[model samples]
Target chain A: MPEPLFLLSPGRSFSSVVSTMIGEHPQCYGLPELKIFSADTIGASWEKESRPGSWPMQGLKRTVAELQFGEQTDKTVDAAEAWIRERFDWSGRQMMDWFQEQVGDRILLDKSPANTENGANLGRIVKAFPRANFLLLLRHPRPRGKSQYSTISKVLDKNGIGGMGFEPDVEWKWTGTNIMARQLGQDLALGQFMHIKGEDLLREMDLYLPQICQWLGIRDDAEAIEAMRHPERSPYATLGPVKAQHGNNGKFLKGPALDFERLATMPEASRDGPLDWDETAEFTPQTRRLAHAFGYR
Target chain B: MTLVETRPAPAALATLPGPDKPVALVRFGDALYVGTAAPDPMGRGRIWRMPWPAGGAAEIVYEGADGSAVTDFAVFESQGTPVLYAATAALGGGLLLASRDGRGFGPVAPAGLGQSGNLWLGPLAIAGGRLVVAAGSAAPLDPEASGARLLASPDPESAVWTALAEPGFGDAENSAIAALLATGAGLVAATANPLRGFQLWQMDPGGGWTRRLTDGAARFSMNPAATALSAGEGELLIGTGAPARPEAEDAAGPAAPEVIALDDGGAWETLVGEPRFSPEGFKVPFALQAAGFGQRETACVTAILTGPGGALTVVVTAVTGATPGPFGQPGLGASRLWRSLDGGESFAEVPAPGPVLAALATPEGGVLAVAGDAGAALHLHALA
Candidate 1:
């Protein structure tokens, strides 16, 4: 069985696209945000929660149906749900190992950002896949943090749900991102963790795409690199079956055609936080230091 | 457990306006005060006070801020006056204390739920001769202050609230204090959101809290929020929801309806196993999976009543949905009534009510079941 490749981050990073792009490799299989590793046991994963607007298991059911049953129908999705219910008491390790074994030699590219939020989550992954490799995907805290702030508040407001105020949201963005930094940087061996920036891959895909392939030691052939660049061609780039309609990121699912124009709108990284969310706020000195450590200016 | 036959569909007692959402129910003096969110979201709330067994002419006792919603209730009788604490859901509503005063309610607790972290304000009880209430952060994303804290107040007069249980104690499995019961063992609390297993926390003599992990969770336990807890024949009967997980469902298959009984002698027994229902004249499993049939989340015991002659009645409501997961619409949230003949050794379903969100024992030797949402009603039934 091929070891899984996990994209670890606090999201709003280009994990979906990057993970999908890597999965586009002929020898690899890209997975949606199954988030199968967030909980210690398979039963625990059902109780796991994330910040608002997090993707649910509709994607996982869809992925399982498409990959295992060879087709997407109401029956297959129902069977997939039943299949999941059947393993209610399995440990997270047992479930992940089963998935890896089922995939056989295909490298499973999983871009589950929540796995990097807590040290306990990372600890579980390390214990589950001793030979697993991690891609520490970083998005500039300034724009990425702002995006998260607006997105979280917008969803809460739209749904009539209550949450922390603007200032706390900014602090949360900083704190969550910092936890990601510490968890991956501190827990893993030097060689096991590879850091990458979303900006580099978006603006300079031709160069960085091949470079990433080389680092992972997958086929560096022209066809393989070209296929890797077209993440939109992946089977999960659009809405899935009726029962499991979402198998990928909402952004990527809508218009997966990769373009660099969105990167132009992002402001330069800043020491000060999104002041609109918090006027009297600045990143903690420790958070700032960690940001710099991630090669952010 | 024997099959208790059907009586009749629970009939409505009174009619209220549409979109009236109930928050909390409390019995103060001879009146049962019901907290309801006004029809208009921005309108002031109305507290309806109904006379016990008489059950006629429910008059409005007090009206609160426009668009305010009540979440929980607490009874505090410290400063010589028995006061009912009504916790408003959102911050703007604040907390209201209802007494037999001129207006019936006044401010008692502050309103700052999402200000610092997730504010937990329930599982109230009288433990260690003090009024105990739970307050903590429930936000899973907020690493700091993201668990439960049991606050103890010596009397209603004292403003100081000391920590009875350490913060983060209920956060072991994203579990927080969900239900509280005053029992012979001690003031007990049940936590929610199961992983390793569910547990019950008990108040000790030293003014501290201890917990007992519930049995039957092999790798992970059900997020059993003890919605209904009753003590009878020196045993505690618990009704809870298993909360079906699409990813990590129980290996025994999806959890069926269940109730657990804890004996006064420190022995815990599973009163109800993987629960099954027989809605007279229909095969429950086939009926539930049929096209028009509705499937709900794991069974949630809503209310348990201890009647005369060592009999116990447990009411369960399964919030059925058109689809699964968090986003599905609850098409048919059904609540059923069950009774145990010999203590709580077993139970039988009595076809009586719809999704009964709440049930209260009436002074007339019967149980008053409040059922449905949107089209809501109050029903009266005799148990045992």
Candidate 2:
């Protein structure tokens, strides 16, 4: 089976769009946020992460529906869910194997942000798939924190996700995921895990995408690179069936096309400035150090 | 001078016996002598010589007991006869050995020059008609006396060593003098500093030591050491990188290995590093090749050997494969060798016979490189 590519990053790191873009490569099959590695077995992942209106399994549902049945719909998604439930004891590796068989020669990519929630989650992924390629997706802590706070704070406030005094501090998640991913990467081969600033990738896809392809030991020709530019062409780039409505970020589902204008005009964030989203928010020393390492000033 | 055709890659000469890592190499009287050590620092050290035109088998001239390894070699003219001197890092400390003929060798100075902490002696140079040796401790044999010290002896037989300056040239952070070169202007020394960066010092004929370059000639902490030095036509080329600790790359960001040149007029120019702004000035790579010869994972340029007819060879320590182990240990990788036919104008990659540990330029314009881990081999790059 082809070694899969995993985009390891926290939320709001452009991982969804970037993984979709990378998946649109001719030789790759980018799947939705299949948060299957959260548990050793698929059943545990389904049962443990269950919540009202929070259908985390939608990604895996839409993924199986599209790849296994060739189209994602109510009936196909239902069949896909049945197939997954039947293999309730299936390990992440087995599910990955089944996906690889469905994709055939193309490399499978999983960009589940939740996979980077903790070191244990990353350890689970590594233990199951030893030769998997990890892309250490990075974003400036400034922008990353802003997006994370604005998006997640509203949801937390309205839904009362944590049930009490749930502070919306994205600091730990952003820094923790990057640190965990880097620690895991250091143990792998030199080229096994790569780091690319999401801002850099968005600003200069022509310059970086081929470099990424070359690192993966894949075709970096004009045709392959051109295909990657159309991430919207991925089957899961849009909203899936109502039953499996979201396997990815909803905003991305609405406008899956690459927004070059917004990307080009994205405001630069300073390393030691007040965050625009939060009035009193200041990055800690650890966050600042990591930001500097990622070429952010 | 003969105009030679450009060749694609270097050719292997002979694979020697066990004790794989080749650390030091020098040319002596039509033969190339390579000093080999077991991969372990304290393992046995052996010197082997290969005949020129390099078809003959490499013969071991001298072998030290376990816990010793030859670190460097320099040839000096003694009373109208050439004598080869080898610096060995041994358990007892550093030893200076001299041999008039390749077959026989004897100690020139007492081990460690009477300082037991100087466990490693390297960067041997003949400066101002004196033998200069840079001595320091690679391991903490004696912490109090561990900093680098420059030892000079006017007469090898007498072995009366004189300190060029204080240990580490008066800076405790300058842990080792990584390289020494007798340039046209003066005797120059490059110190390896962990806290700051590599500092370049020069001693004029008047015996005045001046700090020529500081903060790795403006590269700052990235260049912890200037590992190799070669004298150019009216210029001195210094190769900079932190070679001591490659696995610590995660802790210390990647080393930007650079070959910088300092002219007689106190001017600096970058020969290999990419174009970047420095405190000194806007430095640009003089060579066509990218930084570290296009390998960002390259840790250091180990040797800069200049041969007859302006031929030069640059050997680099590179991380070839992945860092596979759980502790983030680096993967098995080979050092690289690049050749420059037009002085330091441009360079072309010579597919190394193996991971080149040390390389030396032959008098006949051929380059000899030592490579391998279990049992090493001698590779020859001929101008065909």
Candidate 3:
């Protein structure tokens, strides 16, 4: 059997795009984050539920909306959510079993970022599927923080959830989450695990895309290369209901180029900016010194 | 002289029934209870309890209905009645629950516990009729400066808890209070700090606490924190360390947290080091509990070892690993039974039928080992 590829990253680390690219390879099939492993227990109900509001389910919904609905409007997204609620009835394990069935003898790609938060659960996954490989996507602390705040805020706004009174400090959460994931991966000696930077993925997709495919034992052919070039073709591209206008002049469904300059100047609570690259980056001195010493850095 | 015949594999013991999210097990009377995390369907958490000797089936016992997870549990008997206490954290508050029936539990809200940051209550023990509870900060990612606090329940039946003393143990952040024992001297608490290492704290009845022994970076890795505490024959025994940390070229290998034997007034000494037969790199110790023997000085060690395959292997370690073999091999079967004739210096395999999940020495020298996944059966092994 082909080994499953697990993508480990914090929320909003370009996992959707990269995972889709890797899955597009002929030998691979990218999966929506089933998130089955995080449940305290492995059971039928946990797999069937569509946790729409959660980060894991949102990623899954986006993928379904883009693939099944093909529309980015609020009305279309809502319809897609209803569609999912009505149609899918499987637990995370069942979903994985289905994936295995669909891509018989082919490598499976799991793209859930939340799984990084759980060590015991992750350990269970590796134990259950010994051949699984992990691809850890890293992002610059400041920009990543900015992206997370924007994304979380947008989600809250769209769902009509009121904004938290406190300005979101993305740097703190991002750095903390990354540090945890890094420590867990190291502690487990996950031999199949590899780390990739989000900046590198976005700036040099052409070069790195094929490398990822090759690492997962997938053939990087022309069709796959073209598919990688057009990530909008990913099923998750336009998956959710578009949020109501909140003065922000950007489409929530579209993946926009990260504006590093604008992000750097954002308030500490906003983007957690001026993220002294050497300090905020995972395994950097700032994170290592300030955070609990996991001996990873 | 003729050699003694080896006993057959012991029959499977009763299994505990409930959600399989790793559990905290406590035995009171003929009943055993496993405390587990039952987060609300909406994502909050509550404590779920199920009868031990029953497979993993569960019924809600205490609802943090407010959004906290019931992280730890302790059970003790007051005047022949079983009283249960649980530590819970949710919605920015920490609380302890006390129960008379062990089923209908009520909150033991103390006047001023620490703020509702990540904290958990662990190991409930009764000595001299006082209910002693240990509280500590949750894990590394949660927060720091969270030391372990002791709450004394004057009346285990009353839902009132008073802070008796603080262990003053250095930041227990990212570690759990493995086990607590009431020694003739005072109280000894085993704590594992995943990053800083593991240490044993000695607390005097008068309210002074000091570090007894500090091992060099041996407890860090992924070893489970201490879980069981018991006293026998003037020696204190502690079961700790979870599955070993898997070996990596860049990562540290597993550190064998042990079931230690501490002298009457002296510090702790290692009785069982990390088991040599454990899966190559998995460091976490699976399960441990103390068993009582009639003579007080003779106690048995019942422990579960988790291997790379996620299989639970049970073994009985005596003073040394020299215990007679039972099943095909030691430490490889689902569970094996052993006896320690000379304290815990060596171990010999007993005729346990199948893999056992937990074992507690009985007052009669016969051992009671809990087996099956999640508490399925209770196996009784009688020793002559």
Candidate 4:
């Protein structure tokens, strides 16, 4: 079986849209934010998701339904939940194998932001699939932090918990995740992993996507590339059944299409300014150094 | 001229050690040779060779002692065989090494031409049936009469180096010769004078020398050194800036690099830089569409290579000081590659692999660049 390609990045780095587009490629099967790697087994993962405020298990349940029943609905989602409970002892690796088997020879792509939150999560990935391909997607920390705060603030506002001294600290998440992904590169073969800035990819997808396909030794012909343009065509692109309404970002699920105009005119914030959440606190020097290393000023 | 906003990715031939700075690249025999300056003891200023037309892992051909660097590489005909000449930059003195084959090398000239001050030799040119070279001081800009020395040798194997011009071209402030080119006019040498600006001097075939552009070609001393020189269709293309390894006082000085053209009739035209009126007549930048080449930062035009079909590739870098950023240090300023197909009328930016230190035209109609961050890894990449 071919090794899966894991799109790894910090939260709010365009991983959802980019991964969905790449998964739309004829040779790959893009998975939602399974968040299954946080624990050793499917049961453990389910238990972890049961905790409040944890990343919901909607993505995992929806993926099980879509891949097993070839369609996602209320009945299929319930069946998917029961299916997971029946296989409590199944390891995450076993779960990935079953999904890969269902997808045939297509390369499985998983981009779980939570996987990078824990070193053991990434280690589990490499140990389970030693030959897996890793794509470390990066975003300029300034925009990443801003977008992350925007998403969190909107949620807090909707929940009537706005401005309750809940400051979102995005610096650690952005830097820590990318640093872990870079360390992951050291464990892989030379050509088995790559690091690409999300901004560059979105700006010149026509120029870089084919290069990426070539890197994966996949078909880069026009038809195959054209298919990748409409990431919304993916079955998981929309909101799932009410039980599993979100396996991805809510905004992305609402309108999961490439916004060329917005991407082209995306506001660029320099890495050297004070934090948006706190006016007095600036980005740590180490964070700025790492950002500079990634070719961001 | 056609411009591709998105440049195609080029193949990486090799990656030198983190402490190595790739300074020179030349095509010899069936392979491309790369020379690196390693300040650390482990690197030893190594030279590497990769198979041409079929690039793979590059093997180290020669390695120098600690604190030495391969400054430049030149190919010249010795009898019927083409000999490779490698210049060394060292503390005590520089050595000119020669080899009939690319692997093994022997000294062709005495270290520093027997002058301890001439610790660096480079910018070799073959003109008037003789091998001409310039020797100067490296970093920490030496002030011990180790200033620029222009030398020529009719019989290089004999190792007899004759001074073509006085030390520092008779100016103590002219610490080094940053660039040399054999043009239709003669052997042209550009000096690195941080004090009085860069000066261009040409030695004619009749053993006569003439100062072509003085006071940085009317741009004043701001243009301190001529960093690169290349032959145009019917003229000489000169790239001016502060030296890569600059003097302490000149490191933080204002520098807006420029590319000037010199015709055979001794006329001058500024290709890129501030448009001004000067002794060179009313000067206007031909590529006014690309003033400063779209770079607002203080930068220097480092290397220029004119290839087949009138394609010209120029490497520009913002002077980030002598010590390039290593793994832990702040990274060096990014380098940009601009190419022109209609002479200097318009230029298109080509994405570079890293901070390009030097560039050379390949035999296969491509541009090979020696790019690296100082004290960081060096990479040899081809620009298509």
Candidate 5:
């Protein structure tokens, strides 16, 4: 088994498509966002913060059921649940080893941006796979801010959870998530991490992707590059099997076609919006510093 | 629309314990019922009832177990008697209902309930003698067929709850009933699924529910989501906002916040929230704002109430800072009050602390509003 390549990003950072595209490389296997780094032990999922039946555990069960059993059926789900029960106390490194073995020969690719919420969470991934290459994903603060709000806006419309509709609130939340991720990745060994802007990946996939392939030490040949083009062809591309319905991005699950053209039209990030979220609320010093470092104005 | 006078509240309202936010407020008979999000620790939600107009200490009427927000609420007549209905977040928090004549409050379990873990029951309405409710749930994760449900109790007074339409509406995960309206023509409901945009469904006079307005084959474009449903003189008014949720935003639809009007089952026309949801239309924050990026959030129609003879319509919209505004970077962030003088037509901003959570039309034609964030700041306005 080869060392895995991990994607570190905030929610809504287009990590899903990129990671899956990388996994679609003939020499790699895209592991579902195992989120194994969230806890010290696998059973930690069921007992996180003393709240049993957490989403992580549920998500993991679904993932294992689909990936290991090769299908998410009644029997396969039972098998997955039994498997978890059998290895309840396994450490994070142990679980990663098991997945790597299962993904034998193919380099394992894991990207669960949610795990990076706590900076220490990435340390678990680092210790577990010392040779892992960490790819940092970024998006413009402005468009990312609008996107972050879109995620919560319908929530009030659906369940009546209050206080999430504020535009500044939404933007700040986006800023914090991205900022934390960027700050956390700064300390990694230069060779172990690389930064990739979402817009660049989208508008110039042909340009950036080959460089990423070269960096991964994988074949940059036409055939290997062609394989990454059809992420939809991956077994787990379109929604995962029944039990493990998601191992990637929710939006990409709709079709999985990588259309760089659609992302090309995104207007340049602007403090001014038709929605008129406080224009004064432009990129703060912290976000501005990071955006500037990433080559944004 | 213009800003009107701001007056002190006729009386102070009790606050929910801790951060148990006030999620729903509705008028029931001679009393206004306030529903609060469940308190911490126990996660027990509460309902307080206060006598109308003449202010006094509110009485705690119901305490719900689970972290149920008591999100959807309605008090309507059942066989000429008042019946109360409430819904909560997520599956297993069963639909709650109580008849004024029945023994007491209890869970109303619809048949085949508890089928999905994602269904958090919300959106309630009374139309055509039927008590209607919409369940918020994601579509089945698999490609297998299923969706969020639109349910109707032909007699909410009875134990009968059935689907208004077939099982599937849109992609179950993204699809939800955003608003409901009971009109003389039919019981209308609006649905949003990022994939299909937004659609209008009507339970007709013949007891059959059918699709009314939709994008047809163009499932690729922006479908304005409808919320803030209200009654207008001889017409129905619907408020809209941009599709909420980053996952849904992949459609890149426009956030067009415009209030739409329907007259005698006629064409649905842009009423007050036009071109841009410029303050008066009681627009729900935003619908589809293509160019303006920063303002996609921050404001939403929190509540809609009516004055006597249904001549005056008031919408309470709130805007609060999550974090950015704290640094003195202010956008269109403020809880505001908007009014419609000619029954959901022209509008104006009124004097009041914004992000007005709820409002009730006083019998004297003034408006009693529950504004401010988390059930603070109560105020009353005399319509001039």
Candidate 6:
């Protein structure tokens, strides 16, 4: 059997763009982060865990909403979510089966950056799908971590999730997730895994996209490359009214970039304090060492 | 710019043994030793030393205490004899074992090396005649008690191990020794204290150890923290990072605290910053090794970078490996090979393969032996 594609990374690491791009390929089908395998059994709670607010659920909701609902209107998003809950009955494998039915006999790409944080979940993934292929998407940690904090601050502000607490210790989360992935990569030989840089993807899309397609055993024809250009055309583009227009035609459909500088400068006690870039301005030698190791030095 | 395409090797390189675990690559004499964590039922890990070219297969060389996995190993020349040290830990805790001729290894506990049931050793490094090991508590220990202790062996043959220094800022529980570098100044150890952040401390023979850098809070978090210490033209270079950390708010924010250089006086400067050095999404650094470059030196760091693309790439960076660059710029290039002629102030790219897991300097000139998922591939480049 062909290995299932698994994207391992922290959130906001360009997972959406890359996954959608891969999904755009004719032979590849991109599914949202179902995160269903994290549970031991499929049930109501499992369905609950697959909701939009929870980490694992968000990706699934988004994927389903985009595939079924097509737009972010309240009616469409609710219908999509309801459709997903009813279809899979919270069984990850069932969902996989459903995906296979939609895409035919091609490899299914299930991407959930949030799953990267939980080593146990990753273990479960490997156990459930022994033939899973892992594509680790890496972004520069500094900017990515900072961006996560900035994003959280905005989310809390808009949704009234109340004041953010301790910034969720993002630095530790980033390291922990990466460490787990590295250890797993070591445990699983190299042929089963591949690492792609997000910066390279954005800056050198043509080069890396083709490279990824080659690794996935997909056709590297011009048609496949052109398919990636219109990611919005994928069935899994919009999740809710908020995300309805987000991904359409293979393009990133998101709101304008916020001024993270202002949020990053908030005082330490403020909800966005930890996100303050200047407050945490010193680079540890350990970080420098990592940068140098990655050829960033 | 022209794209260069290299033909694939005629034959597929030898694949790693089943149950692929992290392997430490070291060079001894004419052979490159590949040490892997063995799946011994007793828990003691075994080291399989294979001959370089024969690639015939793996041969078990050293077995740790009662089947407990060997967490780390280091090779250093003691006097004129070569000694190999392996950190062995089982359910009982951790111990240091030494092998002289690659065979039987016995416990080499030194004086004043406290016996804590919670000790866990991570990475190992050897420089000069001294051996530096990053010792941490497998579990929480006393705050007044030192968890992360720097142990040094004056001579490799002697079983005498002495505590060189302890981190000043926090307990080993909050902080674990990530990496150690024997620089021109002295032996500098990088400690990552989740509560205190990351700090650089220096250890001297007589005066003991002192804090050299303690701005870890200024950076983000230090998770699965790993470090590499190497010497450049005139400075000591140290590299470290967890999977993720807060970056500079600006476009050219501070580099991920991946590499730093310490001067003779024990002062450190940032050699690289965010965007340039930090891996996108999450990337945790694991291994570091340095190779001498004529009179200069270069080092390679191995890490895992996770991007939003939901893929993890094993990244290996080559740096001055010795000196601290000017204006905090250490080196450059995102390729597998990078060179720094003007000390470490600047770096240029040298093309190499993808997802490099480890690199070692060749005994021959201008050649690097790189191993990755693709296969055991070797690339030769001009130092200039």
**Winner by lDDT:** 2
Name every residue pair that clashes in candidate 2: A189-B322, A190-B322
Docking class of 6: incorrect
Window of ten residues with lowest summed lDDT in model 6 chain A: A266-275
RMSD of 1: 19.8
Show where candidate 3 strays beyond 4 Å: A1-297, B1-22, B27-30, B37-82, B88-95, B110-114, B127-129, B139-147, B156-175, B216-224, B242-249, B265-268, B274-338, B350-377, B381-384
* lDDT (C-alpha) at residue A295 in model 2: 51
Please write out the lDDT profile of model 5 over residues B1-384, one tens digit for every residue: 335566765445444334444556666667667666533323656666766666666666777655444556777777777777776553343455563732245566651244453345566788766777776542111112124577777666466677777643544433566667777677887765434445677777877767665531112123335556666777666555442322222212223244566566555555433221111221222222121212234234444565544445445342332212101111223444556656644556666654444555555444343433354444566554
Residue-level lDDT of model 6, residues A31-116, one tens digit each, is 76566666654454354454365333555556565556564465766676678657655456666666666557678887766467
TM-score of chain B of 2: 0.86
Query: B1-384 in candidate 6: lDDT tens per residue?
Result: 122232322232234444323335555644445444433334445565655543445556765555355556677777777877777544455667777777566767631234563355545766446776656553111112136666667774566666666443354434566666565566667665544445667756664667766544234332223345555555666555432222321111222334445567654554443211121222111212111111011223443222222211223443322112110112322335444444444443446654343444333322233334333443333333
Candidate 5 Cα outliers beyond 4 Å, as residue runs? A1-297, B1-3, B13-18, B38-42, B99-104, B110-118, B138-146, B155-158, B168-174, B215-224, B243-256, B272-298, B306-333, B343-345, B362-377, B382-384
Question: DockQ, per-model, please?
Answer: 0.01, 0.03, 0.02, 0.01, 0.01, 0.02
Candidate numbers, best lDDT first, in rank order: 2, 4, 1, 5, 6, 3
lDDT of 4: 0.73
- Candidate 1 chain B lowest-lDDT run of ten: B275-284
| DockQ value of candidate 5 | 0.01
Whose TM-score is greatest here?
A: 2
**Model 5: reference contacts kept, as a fraction:** 0.00
Instruction: Write model 4 residue lDDT over B95-208, tens digit each, in one string.
Output: 788888898977777788777767777878888877887887663122232468888887787878789888877877777788888877788888876655678899877888
lDDT of 1 by residue, B300-338 (tens): 566787877777677766644322211111233566666
B50: Cα error in model 1, Å: 1.2
Report how far residue A174 has shifted in candidate 4, in Å.
Answer: 49
**In model 6, how large is the Cα lDDT of residue B342?**
41
| Model 5 CA lDDT for position B112 | 22
Candidate 1 TM-score on chain B: 0.76
Residues A84-106, candidate 5, lDDT per residue (tens digit)? 87897998778777777776788
What candidate 4 keeps of the native contacts, as a fraction, is: 0.00
Error of 1 at A176 (Å): 33
